[model samples]
Target: MKFTIILSILFCTSIWIPQNPDLTLDTRKDPVSLKEAAKNHFKIGVALNERQLNGMDDKALEITKQHFNAIVAENCMKSGRIQPVEGEFVWEHADRFVAFGEENNMEINGHTLIWHSQAPRWFFVDDEGNDVSKEVLIERMRTHINTVVGRYKGRVHTWDVVNETILDDGSWRQSKFYEIIGEDFVKIAFTLAHEADPDARLFYNDYSMAKPGKREGVVKMVSNLQKQGVKIDGIGMQGHVGLDHPSLEEFEKSIQAFAALGLEVLITEMDVSVLPSPSNHQGAEITDTFEYQKEINPYTEGLTKEAEQEFHDRYMDFFRLFDKYSDHITRVTFWGVTDGHSWKNNFPVRGRTDYPLLFDRSYQAKPVVKSIADFLQNP
Candidate 1:
């Protein structure tokens, strides 16, 4: 009688449990199994977390295989530490990422040799609070650019040498880099990157450039560069997109505009946040509390069947666009590998749960994975 009851309980549990697709990445097999299918599709990649790779039971390379052709190191290669105190340069982390890429035959996208955020304090002010003169700023910029870029000349394939320089409202956000260096700082940053490695491709990457106002600003920036004969190779659209924001029409238009500039268009930092779908009205404010605020819960409500299908559909839409212009799109990097550790959870606004990535909690490719794989195979 006891055995019969135990068996009955097991049967009940099996019937109720939804079968999750075994999407958790299998370390035993090469992770790049999907890479072959992606070849005729687009360059599929993930922004790497070195710590995650180290913590894995097996090396990522063993499972990752030839799945990616490009990789962006998250925080290791940013401005502050690389150029911690003006002229002094550090290559410890930067070198590791670049070296790993070269060894693996992957293209290394230098994630922002320059940006308005995460900069060392010294870059902005002197010991006494006086800003560094324009000349000093320019000199510091030259030294950092030349040394960093020159050191990895051939190893680093492309660079977001300048990132997020403009605001969503179409104005330059004033950072110490901008104030001390003046307007020419933009020009100088690009110029120095070009000079450092004549063969390397240079880019000015930013978010919200799809908005009409900011798009106009980006158009002007590109036009000016062309007039000056700067070797700006590509425009990286940091595709940190939300469900309703930047409608498909807006996104497609942005792509067309950048390509029209005669530059390659790379969808860098690509992630579509699933939770917090914009309210009934566009741009409606939802209180960010986990509990329902009136009619919405900002964070995800777990992976329900409907939610899984939604993820696949959204990913398919973007993948189709990428396929439509594969020739122009050089790389499409998922900002991080898994949802648990992505920066999206606490960005733009604080204390918000954000799941804006391709892989889910178990490392298993969500329905989105199969969609991408199928697209690659069919394409």
Candidate 2:
């Protein structure tokens, strides 16, 4: 009787254990590419790094080819990376990146022509380390925009002409660009980009765009540019979000407001960070840094089942919102291709393992990929 009781107890324990369904794409009988799924709504894109473009990360390149229909260089096209010095231009990586997109027939986007961050030291300073004069700075801006945009004029379709210029409080960030050249810097940058490639679409890209103050600021700026005939094309809302901030209502408001100004709305640099933020931080300021804390980096082992579900649900909610505004939104681009490749791993607080993409570390598609594919395909 004791032996019988032991067997029954073991069986009951086994039955109570939960089973996780296989979420990888290989296991799925019907796998759909996100690009194909969202083709009718908006183009699906991903940021590509040098490794992926150079064939170093074969899995990432394969995933990029299979899933994304648009490509943007994550860092190579940035001002500092492309032109670290005054006159010298490094075109190897940027050239390779553009070629890869062209080979794939993907819509290529030049990340930025002018920005407060990642700009070369020489861009804003003189030989004696003082700020360059307004005329000198304007010339530098013109040369950089002309060279970069001119290289890929007809090949590249869109450019983030100016990035992160507006502050969250509806004021300007007062970067060296603004301080040296004043507010006309934005207009000049757009004008130079347009002159470089009249056929290419130009955009102003920024983060934390869901704030009412920021929304109003961008609308005013874009509206003013439109009125002045500055050749502006669209606004990129950098979707660097977390689990609980930038409520969908607020994000939708920005989308509506930007679209109301006759500008194409592109959801750019999107990543849903699953780790606990450092002090409720929502903006994607690359310079923002904080010391690493154990509590803030809670998911070092991996995301919990509950956390994974929450992550999945959060993405679905955002996608639903995007679908509703598909008429206004042109393209939706993820910041990175896989969780391991995500900047979230070392961002805000360095050395934290974070799962914040549709693909896991092994290049396997999470259930959310299939769910999104199914939802968009069927909807």
Candidate 3:
């Protein structure tokens, strides 16, 4: 009876081996990056500036190469910066941006094809300084899209064809394109982008995407485009989230709704500002600049322990949410690399020391980075 019991125990303890044990990532690597940690889930990206593109900011570029697998031009690719004057394409900066991405094997995203701000003054206004006629504007739009999109035809994997077109109230933001070409401008932009690079993905990026009205409106608008047989592949919810505003629940709703519309969701421009706002809630707009004040820039010394903890929690929560919907989200691109590189430092209120990004000013990973990296390690 004792021998039988021993044999049964040995049989029960026998090991079983799988055919593909390597399919699971060994997450025990130390000092892992946000991009590598979450790579199996989805891509991690960062936007680039002139310094990084020109190889001036060696530290930022090194961190980028180590951690990130995707890149977008922070300003160089913008219409105003690239074109400046009509028909005079300044391709040097953009070329470098693409070259950097290609060398690193990173997925490249073109920031914008049409936006009200940051375009050459000549883009919308005529030689007489008036808004150009619809025909002239559409033709100019066609040329701009074709030229820019055609330049990086297969290099850029995705393009922000139209940016921030809808307001929080679900109404179209009136710009030269809206006033002259009407809503059809969105369709035209997508068509031109598709014509320029049919293989590349096309996306409509916007801010305030979590609001119910805006979410609904974007769904309907994109649905209409899909109905018209326009190949809109993704929607970029500018992740310019704050510590408290735009509740996580609402943001998830935006993802679910967009995914329901059969569109992939890209969390573009993600950063969490941990500073008291001048107004109720500030936005990421080039026109939304403010005069620097001593009081608003309170964290110049450094963030308080409480504030830092809160910032860390906010990031972990958002990333956990991102993990939850990893299937629907194809990419999550931080707007900047480190806290020092963030635009939030001067946005809405200038000179404010906002601790909004995953890395500190020194490019060291913060607690939130560890939290995310740890999570990825475990999974």
Candidate 4:
């Protein structure tokens, strides 16, 4: 009888109960604070300049620096935009980014030097306005990579050597880059990046690779790169999720699959977009009456409360998953510093309002931040 009682007590004690069973992650009740959470986690980075960084009134930047190991300058070091006229590498923003990291002793990540979207127009054409041949493109790629990557060889810790090469449908994206330079461009870029800075880690970053098809494509790409003697170091899955899209199970599978591929995974550019429109709510009610009138604030016209809550809920839930898989995820980068400057608020579907990030314009940590902090610390 005593043995039975002892066994019962032991079983009950062994049963895992989440710290807050009520699913309430109020910051007040959060004994496990952000500072505590960040201690056990990888990194936290905000994408903005001095205005936003200095805008944090409560010395949040100092507080955050105490926790996060690294910072990524969102767009300060892109291809054409950073070095617009070619050979005239404007170091204004890039210098500031590196300086901030130095000042804080933070491991800096150079966002990218090669990507399809933000390349300068001159890169696409020769002095004669004709499409540059693959040779010239490769030279330009090497030169650009050498110049930029070389500039911060030891200072910057990692580089998103390649970004968004795969499409959402798990196919190679059809861009002027791929169309002109061929698949070899990807390999050459990484090789040159490695040559420029043999010590720095290199990564291939993309979004929507959480989907099975896209995951498979990435698996193949990474495997092929490995076989070809390329120094491809990591893969970054941009976790830009909608409330209802890519269920948690699917996301977990993606994580497990990538980790199984023997590469470090970074949950780069994570944000859950809850827009100001009803359709933004996954299960929003729709009248069969073909009324375009519902499209009021076409950008953020119809965000429902339920959807907002769901968006917030998923943000927490995803972090819980992050905590569970923290062993695999090396970093979690919030795309922007605040909702006010989020790319989701406008882009792809331009003029649409988006509330995809964790902080408001004021840099106050939102519930999502608390949720993530809670999980990171407690777990």
Candidate 5:
């Protein structure tokens, strides 16, 4: 009797100790990188500025390599920076950016082949400053797309073929591209991109994606494109959220709606701004500007514990949402790696310190990083 009792106790102990030894606690304490922790869910990515790619910021580079498995050029790959002169292309910074991604085995994303805001003045105008004919603009676009996309070809994994073409009210922005080439400019851009690199995935990226009108507009536009046999592979919903704005329900609805169209959905350019902004601020418009006020920039010294917790909670909620739809979200990319590198500081309201990234100014991962990893690992 005594021997049997001892044997039973030992068997129970061995089973518990060997098979399930405090998995939850162990995972929480484990220093798993974000990419590894979320590998099963979706790819983790970050935007890299020229400084990080040029070896000027070793600390940022190290953190990026450690935590991110995908990367996008913040500004270097944009139309203005890549080809400032019409025929003269700039390759130094862009080449370094692509090479860095390849050396690290990271999935590279080409930011934008065409955008109205950052496009060169000459692209839509003649020497007399008059808008070019539709044919002239189309040829210029073809040349630019062919030159840029053809050069990268197999290297870049995805391309944001057209950006910010639709407005918040579901109407097309009357930029030079639209005024001259009309809505077909979007079709032309996608076709040209496809011709440049058929293997590369193409995406239509935009902000204010959760708005009802914008969501419906994008759905209609993409549906029309599909009818015409456009090779669009995904829809990039720019995740530029605030602590309070962008209702989670609405965002999820947009995701489902986009996915219903049989296209992959990507949460791109994600960041949470903790600072107050003008009530009129609509979306991630780079040209929007406001005069600075001390009340708006309250956290110049540091975020108070309350504010920090709010920031943490905001991030946690978004990550939870992203995880819930992991099957539909192919990638979740932060706009910047560190709070110091984030454009939030100067966006809309200038010179306001904002803690809006997974890493702090000192290159240390915030508690939210581990919290996110823990949740994803355990959930």
Candidate 6:
């Protein structure tokens, strides 16, 4: 009877258990982070805001150090934050941001050198508030890039030299840069950024790149830059996705499209929100506004088990895709360290509760964290 029972127990265990057993075993260990899980795959990064950078939120800071191997300043490194006036550069915030990255031994990503938004109001206007001449604007741009990029040439490794220059239709967004310098603004921006730090890798970053038109536009732009002898290193696809929008097929198609080019692909500003949109609009534009309704912000109290499980499944699917293309991807960065700090709560609609990252508001690893580790480890 004892021998029969032992054989039966072994048979039942094999039927219920994972083939390798390590997959199930890893999930039982202390939560493993995206960085460690993807350490061999690619860099894992997070964007830090002023409070987190200053350590005002100690727990958020602690969590960031534990998971991220790369860091990008959420606002400190932007043009407006770094240089609000014509020549006066605000060094306090930017300095600390870089210092924090250096201390953590994280690869620092300079948020941007030239962007249509978050640029100082003074950049496009003269003393009397008239639009500046193209030559003057270009000169000011070079100076801004030189100063900021020179300050941290060796310390910061990658830079978004220009952002959101391509529209969804694959045409140039008619911004101050384009209107002032025509289409050559992108070329000039990359040139000056490279001049400031030749060693620093420069990237063209944008949102909605999963759209076929936008992807084609970016690819054409990068190809043109290469033909013109520009030093474009990578393309940053801002991964601000929701639970339902952006089918995995579309996102993967973009990854394949971008990798076909010679540059490395970076999944930047990543976040997957598990909440209903106020107006069903999917965008991260600062100017986008929506009226807050409790009905729309149902998850303000917190996500239900069903919602949480769906979020877990969505994140796992995305990471599986990331791992599949890890060879072509250089880095994958979360937009924020924790859900509490996510801009999704305020973007497109304000004061709406959202859970978008691997960490919860309490800075605890969500169940998805363990799953991500197991997925990559087992795969």
> What's every prediction's RMSD, in angstroms?
11.0, 10.1, 8.9, 6.6, 8.3, 7.3
Candidate 5: misplaced stretches above 4 Å? Answer: 1-31
Which lDDT tens digits does candidate 3 get at residues 136-175? 9999999999999998999999999999988887888888
lDDT of each: 0.69, 0.88, 0.84, 0.70, 0.87, 0.84
Per-residue error at 296 for model 5, in Å?
Answer: 0.4
**What C-alpha lDDT does candidate 6 achieve relative to the native structure?**
0.84
Whichever of 1 and 5 has more lDDT, that candidate is: 5
Q: How many backbone collisions does model 3 have? A: 0
The superposed Cα distance between candidate 2 and the true structure at residue 41, in angstroms, equals 0.5
1 or 2, which is superior by lDDT? Answer: 2
Name the candidate that leads on lDDT: 2
| Candidate 6 lDDT tens digits, 1-379 | 2234543454444333233233223332457766888887889999999987776988888778877889988899899989987889998888898998899899999998899998998999998999999999999998999999999989999999998989888999999999989989999999998888889999999998888888899989898988999889999999999899788898999998889887899999999988787667775667788887777888878888778777877886677678667878989999998888899988777888899998888777877787777656655
lDDT of 2 by residue, 152-243 (tens): 98999999999999999889888999999889999999999999999999999999999999999989888888889899889999989999
Local accuracy of candidate 1 as per-residue lDDT tens digits, 105-209: 777888778886777877666679888787877777787788888888887888888887776666776877777776667888988998889888988888765
Better of 2 and 5 by TM-score: 2
Q: What's model 5's overall lDDT?
A: 0.87
Candidate 6 displacement at residue 60 in angstroms: 1.2
TM-score of 3: 0.90
Which residue runs does candidate 4 get wrong by more than 4 Å?
1-35, 50-67, 276-308
Worst 10 residues of 2 by lDDT: 14-23
lDDT of 5 by residue, 1-379 (tens): 2234543454334332223222224232335699999998899999999988888999899888988999998999889999998999999988998999999999999998989988888898899999899999999999999999999999999999999999988989888999999999999999999999999999999999999999999999999999999999999999888888788889989998999998989999999989886765758989899998888899989988777777877887777667667777899999998999999999988888998898889887777787778766765
Give a tens-digit lDDT track for model 4, residues 1-379.
2234543453345333243333334543322334446655566665555444445433446434644557787777887657899788977778877877888777788888678877898988998899999888888888899999999989999999988887655788787789898887889999999999999989998877667878888888888888999998788878777766768888889888888877888888777876433434321111111223324334354346555567667777777666566666778877765677677654434456677876555555556665566555544
lDDT of 3 at 363: 72
**Between which residue pairs do clashes occur in model 5?**
none
